[model samples]
Target chain A: MLEVLAERFNYAVIIVLMMVGLYAVIATGNLVKRLVGLSIFQTSVFLLYISVSKVFGGAPPIFDYKDLAYDKLDPNAIYSNPLPHVLILTAIVVGVATLSVGLALVVRIREAYGSIEDDTLAEADYSLELEKGV
Target chain B: MSASDITQYFDYIFMAMLLCIGIAVIRLRNLFAVVMLTGAYSLISAAWFVSLDAVDVGFTEAAVGAGISTVLLLGAMLLTSREADKTSLGRHAAAAVVTIAAGAGLFYALGDMPVYGDAASPANTGVGMEYVDLTAEQIVIPNVVTAVLASYRGFDTMGEVFVVFAAGLGVALLIGLGGSKREED
Candidate 1:
């Protein structure tokens, strides 16, 4: 029963992490906190992909002549799927780019508004908008 | 239920949880909460994609959904406010309902997807066979997915790179790249 329950435990863990991150993003009004939540959420998804790429009873794409037996191929070898890993590498690069851009935006926002709080910025922008007459 | 039956039920449960999370995300009163919920929604969707065996897509979803999107949203949140407009809830609900209905209809329309590992699948039977079979000689890459993404679909990858560059340029234009110089009145 335990084996069955844990058959796809990776998915379960990913889901839980996702929920926590989502909750954090929603519950926190602080800008940095929301970014943390987003990172958590994304990490879980990455885990899910890596886990799913695992093929049971397949050998790693790497070749080890010593591991190969004479008579018949070993049925127990498990080769992980490498495609998802490569895709994730690209995604990580993208994520870094996004992070730097976002941080830049935050800096600009801080410069424009003395405070970073959502309410304060809104009020400040509102007055500016008011000055412009809608 | 047998062990496999239990696993099947768990799948249903996961799907239910995903739907509930989606509802919670859209219903939340705070904008920050909503953005976070959106991340959760994407995470859950990534899990669902993994279950369907689209592992590469799952990876992309996880990174974009959780890591970068949340950061961008948080940054944007700092410039705005978290409080949901009290008067807009009704309109939001209407929009959500419409979106859900449309999405469901589209899903129903695509109901003939081949079952996992079907030998006769287009992926297994068509030109995919030649590619999969010839991987040893043609690309020498053991990973078919990599071959497809980097070589077969190379131009699409270029387009994606262009999109990212354009987005960066657009943001730079909005915020004014380099150290901000206080405008001389």
Candidate 2:
């Protein structure tokens, strides 16, 4: 049981981080806080992919040409999976792009509604609806 | 102890730090502190990435996560309020319930996962190995990650660039490029 726990502990940490992010997104009323939660969530997923790509006794995915000549390359030379790293490189860029857009929307919300809190904005909308009905 | 043992200990330390940061981000009411903690969280995660043999990913994470994201969040903070309003108990309870349920489900699935750093795991074999083996002959690049990212997956990278462009366009269209220029006009 202890060995299993040790082996799978990375996933366990990731899941906890993910849960914290999700809770923040759901529970926080502040728009900026929600975006922070979203970022935390996105980052946890990044960690997960990188963690999955790790190989024991492996080097980083950079080839040492002197030690690993093209003609006499060792097939047993271990490297962490580069495919996931490639995927995550794009993901980190996309994550930032998404974050910038989200922040822009939050700024726009504050400007238009005069409040960034979800509850305050909802209450204002409700009052506006009541005024229109009367 | 062996090197792997030390690496494992480092992983544990990083994970514990991340957990503490995550909880702090959640419990803190001050937005400035939260933003700073988020950047620290990213930097620590980047360090963890390096230990995991993902140098390129770590480099990118440090630049984008800790640097750009923190700046962007600070800019947004300037436009918005600093303190988050108190959330009600009921809402907190509901979110906790949902998060716990989701976490339990994922935890149950974790049993079937390959042990950490098992080289023969499915993710490390097959196509990943193929890229590692082929890069020397095909791309002649020292960095297998660079070779695969720029060559084998060039189209994907192009698509990602387009996505980033679209996001920038969206932000500009929504709020303009910076300063009071858009507001003044």
Candidate 3:
């Protein structure tokens, strides 16, 4: 039981973090808070990917050539998987791009409605529906 | 203990910090403080990534997550209100239920996963190793991640670039490109 716990503890923590983000996204009425929650959620997923790629005794994926001159390369040198690193690097940038776009939308919504709360926006829509008789 | 043992402890500490920050962000009503906390969370995450042997990813996370994202959120906050409106307990409870359900489902699935840091696991044994091995001969770049990103999976990156470009265009269209022009008009 202890062994399993030790092995899976990181995943457990990540799940808790993810749930917190989800709660914020769903429960918060503020648009900026929702985006912050979304970012937390995204970062947790990145942690998960980076965690999966880890090798117990691995070095960073950068190749070291210092050993090449002294002797033949050590055949057993371990490296953490580079593929996920590459993917997540791109993802982090893309996450920011999407975040900026979301914030821009929030700014525009505030300009149009004069409030950034989802409930306020919903109330406005509800009154509009009453006026439209729909 | 050993260096790896110390790193493991660091991993636990950073993860604990991340959880605390997540809770703090949810609990804080002041958006400015919350945004700053999120940036701190990202910075800690980057440090954790370094311990996990993902230096390149850590560098990008520090730059994009901690730096650019925080700046963007603060700029957005300037145009919106500072304090978040209070949410009803009923909505909080409903959200908690949904979050707990999702978390429990993932927890159940977690049992089937390979142990953390098992090099022989499917993920570590596959083409990830192939890229690490082939980068020297095929691309001659010391950094395997860069080689695979720029050469092996160039198309995927091209798509990501397009997505980023589209997002920038959307932001500019929604809010004017020049900040001064918006204020002037």
Misplaced by over 4 Å in model 1 are A1-134, B1-10, B87-97, B100-104, B107-119, B178-185
What's the lDDT for residue A102 in model 3? 96
Ranking by DockQ: 2, 3, 1
Query: Model 2, B154: alpha-carbon shift in Å?
Result: 0.8
Question: TM-score (0 to 1) of chain B, per candidate?
Answer: 0.75, 0.94, 0.94
User: Global lDDT of each model?
Assistant: 0.54, 0.90, 0.89
Q: Which of 1 and 3 is ahead in TM-score?
A: 3
The residue-by-residue lDDT of candidate 3 on B1-185, one tens digit each, is: 11233467788899889988999999999999999999999999999999999999999999999999999999999989899999999989999999999999998888777678888888889999999878776776678898999899999999999999999999999897987796787
Q: Model 1: per-residue lDDT, tens digit, B104-155?
A: 5533433343322233334234554444444444665555567756886678
Q: Per-residue lDDT tens digits of candidate 3, residues A1-134?
A: 66675687788888888998999899999999999999999999999999889887788988776654444556788889999999999999999999999999999999999999999999998999999999
Error of 2 at B131 (Å): 0.2
Models 1 onward score TM values of 0.54, 0.95, 0.95
Question: Better model by lDDT, 1 or 2?
Answer: 2
Supply fnat for every model shown: 0.04, 0.82, 0.81
The digit string of per-residue lDDT tens for model 2 on B115-185 reads 78888888788798899888988887789998888899999888999999999999989987767797888
Give the range of the ten consecutive residues with the poorest summed lDDT in model 1 chain B.
B1-10
